[model samples]
Target: MNEQKIFDNIKHALGEAPRNQFTTEMHLQMIKYADNLKSITAKEFCEGVGLKPSFGTEFSKMRNLTQRLKAAGLNTNQL
Candidate 1:
């Protein structure tokens, strides 16, 4: 994926500046949360994170955000 494009998309979706600091633990926490709530759906995940899930776009967006987080030095499995 185009990392910059994905980052920009997340920034626009969140309506906030990108965070420069995030630890592996934090990434894992979010991943775990997403995993645990199987039925929660990506729509719910976006809602929990304070985003609208009405169009089903947030689901893919959330995945991209997490992937970007991982690329930003957050470990995928270090919770």
Candidate 2:
């Protein structure tokens, strides 16, 4: 999917909710987007997802998720 579409979906799923309310699916969507993006910064991802770049830990986790998903050939255990 295009970056805009991915960002819109991520925003629909994860944005406007408190971080604690984010579901695993929502996070996975974000991680998948992170992986799909060839070169993106935390600031750029946050902007695209309508989030604050202050969420550094979350971004870090997303990067880790990207690696894990890639290592596993993008196969994921759906929740």
lDDT of 1 by residue, 13-56 (tens): 44443455333323333453333444555565555554455534
In TM-score terms, candidate 2 sits at: 0.66
lDDT of 2 by residue, 9-74 (tens): 778777565778775655677666665665777778778877767765577677787777779877
For every model in order, what is the number of clashing pairs?
0, 0
Q: How do all models score by TM-score?
A: 0.33, 0.66
The segments of candidate 1 whose C-alpha lies over 4 angstroms from its true place after superposition are 1-18, 22-26, 52-78
